[model samples]
Target: MRSRQFGPRVSKDGVSFRLWAPAAKRVDLLLDRALPMQRRDDGWHAVDVPGLTAGSRYKFRIDNELEVPDPGSDFQPDDVTGPSEVIDHGAYAWRAKDWRGRPWQDAVFLESHVGTFTHEGTYRAMIDKLDHLVETGITALELMPLADFAGRRNWGYDGVLLYAPDSAYGRPDDLRALIDEAHLRGLMVFLDVVYNHFGPEGNYLGHYAPEFFTAAHTPWGSAIDYRVPQVRAFAIENALHWLADYRFDGLRFDAVNHIFGVRDEIPLLHELSAAVGDLATETGRHIHLVLENGDNRASMLDSAEDPPRGKFRAQWNDDYHHVWHVMLTGESAGYYGDYQDDPRGDLARALSSGFVYQGKRAAFWGGEPRGEPSGHLAPSAFVNFLQNHDQIGNRALGDRLESIAAPAAVAAALAVTLLAPTVPMLFMGEEWGSRRPFPFFCDFQGGLADAVRKGRRIEYEWAYSKYGDEVPDPLAVETFKSAVIDWEARNQSPGKERLALVRGLLAVRHKEIAPRLPGATFGEARAGADGLLTADWIMGDGTRLHLIANLSASELSPPRTRPAGKPIWGGALTDRLLPWSVLWSLGEV
Candidate 1:
């Protein structure tokens, strides 16, 4: 049980390094050292290299056989597997002095991966693209996880080091610059973080601290031991560090269900939420916590007689997206089997009630019934999206919904998602209908790379056995490369049309509906025999809006007696709504 601290320290010439390896008979500073050296007492080994500056690559040579990279390496250009580099995180001059924070309820989030977002695959490169997002009416940006992982090229879910940002995206300062630039443009940034499990390769937390991981296993690897005092502190402290130091507006927790603790009374989620709230108050900035819970549990937001509600601002409503996807595409395979035929009913239920599975058995889950979200929760409490990284990447060929469905249907889905009762999110290039396939790919060292390939194949094989010939190998480099968005596509006719539709929908939502409701009361739609569904939404301020959606492919005019005298902002009568399309209008009679 020995502790080792290796990092850049203040020195006249630069910095010095010291490590602890009591078990080893010998230790040496591998930076510019041709030979190994002996260890000292007090379980400490020291080395002073004045000329070795930050970004210097180094490793530790222990017992002559083990040559490991610096445990605190700031950059790993060669591979995710090797040693670390010395980096002074404090060296960067931050420029986001005037930035406060964006409120979660009002945010329009855009999710993107750093590697594919730009050709350079650096944070600086992403900073240059912020203007496009800002102009597109997006209020916030959600970056995919960048925690230190096994390779320079990865989706980042396989991150092994929780505290370190991926060096492939440039140094810590580069990230700071990106965030600062985004803030300057009035865009709040939310980082995706994984706390459920660590990737298999380059995971050395167990070696550094046995309590860092628990015996309980996850699909990825060992589950973090939140029950242990040290482990609890580590998780909380790591979260606080990102917010306090990096100035990130919020965090999107990867898979919170797996963050299990033995104690029933004090769940790890409660503790994490409390910590985030305290930090937010102390910093005088609003910080949001979002969860990616597939279980559809309502208690996730409930903090009754407990610590502050699991500091989560919202959770992804997968049921809503799944139902919408199924209805639009009419595909029934994998988990979507249950969602095939009856989409209108499920969608209507999800809109009026927060949970679509309320008291209904989940055929795929093989469960009794899932609980519904409390009435107290606002529509903003749910983050809705038609497609995300997983939905696209998990496909056999990693085809996005836009690619599978007709252009008109895709446009209609976007309109429906934007007008829905939840906060809307769009994956990169989704608004413009980018045809790129977001495939699952990895770059790991040695035999680990092959293992990742095999694992991905097995998962997709089982999921898409019906389309055996269509399935693309997840390990193929081309599969991952093809996922990158083509910047040139933004100017095309179809892209422009799709972008305009999204802009129109968002403008209506923000300008007319959002201001009126603040928090509106949702009413179920009563469809006519002609196949038009109509609902009445009354705002908190008594402003009433009558919405009529034509869900069929053929155009059918509503009766002349249908709530007349209301100044219609827009509507589609002769304009046929390709099956699955929706039309929303706002005004008072």
Candidate 2:
């Protein structure tokens, strides 16, 4: 009820259409033909067209000149530019009627992109791969954004129709089927949503309501005006639609730092949290909200107490990824420079506490203080990943770290990511070490096509100029095709080995570590004279777990005294660790 029902409100008897276009002098609902709409006092236009049921496609004829898709389209069956369709969400018979979803304490996430996740690149095709997800020992599947963007394929971040699922992936029912299957397989589905800037093409919101976006800046062009009432309502309502209508387990809020601020910002997140909290209580389902913030706004995390009350349940921790990436690859760029001063110390801090900056002046921010201390937060509130869509695709060539990092070093990073006390999300194809590159790819309209092509080159303008175009054309179909996971790799040499290692580590984590997440704690990573990074920590079961890794190419001696508990994993019990190796001990050392 936060947002006024903006789209067609489906009914057994006809349908009622409403739209807010305060700027428009005339607005009409154009179905088979035009039906004039009466202007309302609340800056909205209303029209009740009888004999219209679900699946009836219609466009709002604004100013009696241009007919465009609904601002709150439930489904864009044809594409982003197509007319919006009325969908009866109650039509489908969903499975898992009794599933309450896996909680944060036991969540091991699989972050996947639907288009490139499989050969077919549809929701039905994605469901076919659920077996691998279950085999990977992940409890949740976090999909990249699926909102309707322009053209046939995209990263989904450029989505304009915020409520409609991408038609490229299949109809609304297909997506629903996929979620149902995932739930049946005991995998909670989380959607990544972009609420910052609308994609360039076919976004008609500004045509009707120009106040949707504000003057604030975001990494993705411009910021959304969270200060506007209807805007806030639309945002919150969209979130609830996903949670209540589609029955998703949670949402991975993309780029939370960009979504609000420059005004009373916290209220947006607060109100959303309150609403979702209420929805959970009513449905007897726990719907989690996660934030992605480079600044680590740990203060926004919901409390650790029972029936937790507050904002988001967790946040993606970039500090962990930044330090880990540097430690393994020794490649530091951009914000990574801040941790180069004491990578191990920073890693240690990230391990023990959730944030490394903690209200201190950030060297990356030109010594401006950022990110309040997160020591008070529970470890589960910090999501850790060695590789994600951005870490891999943002590269000029979209090369996975596995392509460059030493095999052993990659394995060590994987172990740390999964074995750590925090929530872990595995990028698609990461487990089996698929050699495919996940390059940035998109399909845009003609005019925007050239601009997007140029934008890709200019995204890292220096690379395009200096490296002489290190990236492939994002507009090319082959560029998208090349990113698909080679399923054959799972049966081959190094890929098989990598798969075994990943599965083995996940098995160990699920059995020994996952249950302890609610109480697990992390300490800082300390370095020894031999260049080995070591961290001794306590698990939820009061058992001591010691992590020691040799990231260098040469073999090194182990600790003077063995780790507490027996070596549950790795060569921790031995005196020497092979280059780029790690040891995880469980019993007293």
Candidate 3:
């Protein structure tokens, strides 16, 4: 559905163009030559140039005037300002046709941002580190959004060209190569996509069809009008485009809670989820659909019997992170306020159900009722992570967990994230505990750049009053440079130690806990005096895994000595857990 039917369809010898501008009286194909298009039965304008070749740049002239990049452009090599290039979607020769993708349950995601993941910060350069990721036991690579924005560096939430890969990361084929390499090496790759709003700069969608957006405003920008047939088609087309054209296994939709003013039903989100299911069935590929919705709506992943056609594979479990963050850092700020009291129960709820809120009134929701009941959901439905791009990068200093919490505390959290019956995601360089600070950085030049800088300064003023001006300006090049990972650190002493910890934990998980994930999981969590949280998971197969974690800075009660239980990872834990520490034992009688 990508290039074969939509966008600029490049055949053996010519280029055919199509546009869906019901508002436009006339739209022409403008490139090496201007060609008038005929209005189709479906209200789409279409024209074909018999001898036009690939690599030529083109754009659509709307209403005999304003030229904008194609809404489904494959390659915007010259970025947003220039013409969109013609590229055949079937051009690349893929080497991993046999790569059927790993099972969804075996997914251990390593969330990476291409711009800061490596010094080169290109798709090709990212491919070079795939082996390191495989060694770290990451079965799937989850990239931050790669959609073309206005400039070189961004967190990628602000994307304008939904169909075009960011040119800063390299050409279209470069991205295809990275995916192909990952597949060949027994790793699956997925992309993060922003569907709620478009970027402020270089957005040309509204110029052609103003009806593409609505009066509703999201936190980032203008909300899309899903009720409009063309708008819904535009979004759904973009989703299938990434899968069909780019071979992306699936997508992580950013902030569906901001997609619309929610009332009763999420029609567009459900429709997109169903569409993904259809695509997977059609292609015979294992596709996954994940959401980062703040509202833990159970309907998002319900069985096919339910309304709204719930079929998503998983969602980002922020409840898990919130509980751990407050416990480990004693932070009662912002959203953390919701979990400050009796956090151990919340953690237990996060473990038992996939969501902590579960239709309860949350303090973070201004003491309002939020989050649907999700207690019936499977544990694997939650994507749990201790250090994701948001948890670290949203801070005043963009500090990782290592900076704010003790090593023992960090390890305790990692143990839960890795060993529990949940989908675990590791942020880039997390295994080696890289010190690179992933601050919010964007190259929104001129007025927008000044606005971002000023806005960041004002937003973090309270933090500055308390912690000083150590918060790097989001618009600076230095901030972007500072975030790039130093690949050499993985071999160093401390880095190697962290790496070994992760490797051993994952090894144990694959050997012991993985088999139990498919079976019934019975878990019990208890909060003791002196900042201690104890959790035990007994599987249907009679394999029991116990965790005693101390989130405090000082040591708690002593632990009992291990007789014959295998200790595969992390630090020691006897009767009492060490301060900020956890102990895991297998086959304990």
Candidate 4:
């Protein structure tokens, strides 16, 4: 029931409209008719409409010429370019009113894009598959960005309206229903939010409030200037809006390294974490905050804190993914090149410590040292995954690991990832080995569409040369269609086997590993000369979890160190470790 400065505030006196437009000479509220708004100090324009209420559609006419949707509109029934619709947050009746969310250690995430999750691609449609996820042993459903974009389809990253949920999906209540249903089924829902920069199209802020953005630019667009109090409040309130208004279990911040802050000033990241932490404490909710920071700032994470205490619960461990990827696919281009030099060793480091590049120089990262030391953190501080949206979608062809890596090798990787003490995440269809390409697709039109096409072509020139005319067009409707996973595949031959494998692995993770993951400590891990990997960890209950893997194509001699306790996954310890073999065990420490 908290009021936010960024959006329309619904009260007993009706709807109060507010806009921050310092540069405009006059701002008018366009409802049934254009009405003058009082310009207050600090560039805020406000008007109290006594008769207006929720579901009222309105826009702001700037200087009597340009009318733009509210930047903080809760719902955009039309596309982002159309008029904004007022939404009363308290209107929807939540079914899971008592859902407080699950703990961080129990999290087994399945990252999904709601639009491509099913044929209908609506929030309500996604509810049908919730049972399948529960059966497959997924504890959490992590959705991609939902901020209103310019068109009918997008990856959801190029979101211009940070507050509004895109109309292409469904109404605001539909999304709430999805979350409500997820909680009812005991599944936590986390949203992937982009606060680094606004999308390229349908952004009208620069026309009126140019101070919202900095002169600098991110990889996507102009960086937001968070130094301004209003700009900072906008982002902070937006984060809370998702957590407080929608009741999401957690949030994954996308590309946070781009969100710049000064040393003297309290960084926006710290302030936002503090605000979220306060909410969690006040509400007595087990809210988790995860980051996708490329900087590998271990200082930002503190799993020890109950309410987070201005720190995040975990970070997406790209280092774990990169090393496994290099070992499986033999990729040596771009960032993958960093792990190619000693992939086995890198994997060992990732398995032992939280990060592989702990102040070490990375060849792919301009030969510069990156990441802080992360060995002291809890094992749950890193969210490990073999594949994610960026790892697959950013590829020139959007090829998944199962498509490129050997089947046995892929299975071995999954066995290690799923059973490890760290939290594990899966891309939507990975459990069923869905090979449908998740190519980068959008619904941009006109010059913006042309620019996107050209950029994709340029960025993937090598791919174009190799598969010319075969690469899916970024703006075509068919391209988006191709990304929709085949649900029937789940019941098919190999898909069933893969799904069973993941389910069994996760069953062990939840039963044996998750309960003892609280105070887990990292143990030593090493790679031998003959495709042999040995690692161990001490669980919170003082149980030792050990792993032994032989990743090469040929049989290798057993390591001097054998698995510790009862055989959890792979068959009994053999005299000779077979090719692509992986074994997990748990013993008393």
Task: Show pairs that collide, candidate 4.
Answer: none
**Full ranking by lDDT:** 4, 2, 3, 1
Best by lDDT: 4
Give me the displacement of residue 508 in model 2, in angstroms.
1.0
TM-score of 3: 0.92
* Residue 204 CA displacement from its true place in model 3, Å: 1.5
- Clashes within 3 Å, all models in order: 4, 12, 10, 0
In angstroms, the error of model 1 at 330 is 0.9
TM-score, predicted candidate 2 vs. hidden true structure = 0.95
For candidate 4, write residues 55-76 as lDDT tens digits. 9999999998999999999988
Off by over 4 Å in 4: 262-266, 460-465
| Cα distance off (Å), candidate 3, residue 309 | 6.5
Cα-lDDT of candidate 4: 0.90
lDDT tens per residue, model 3, 458-556 = 755544456566778788899999999878888997889999989888887777776666544546666655666666666546766776666667867
RMSD of each: 4.7, 2.1, 3.0, 1.4
lDDT of 2: 0.81
**Residue-pair clash count for candidate 3:** 10
Q: TM-score for each prediction?
A: 0.85, 0.95, 0.92, 0.98
Q: Compared to the true structure, candidate 4 yields what TM-score?
A: 0.98
Q: TM-score of model 1 relative to the true fold? A: 0.85
**Which residue pairs show backbone clashes in model 1?**
69-83, 73-84, 73-85, 74-85
- Candidate 3 residue-wise lDDT at 556: 77
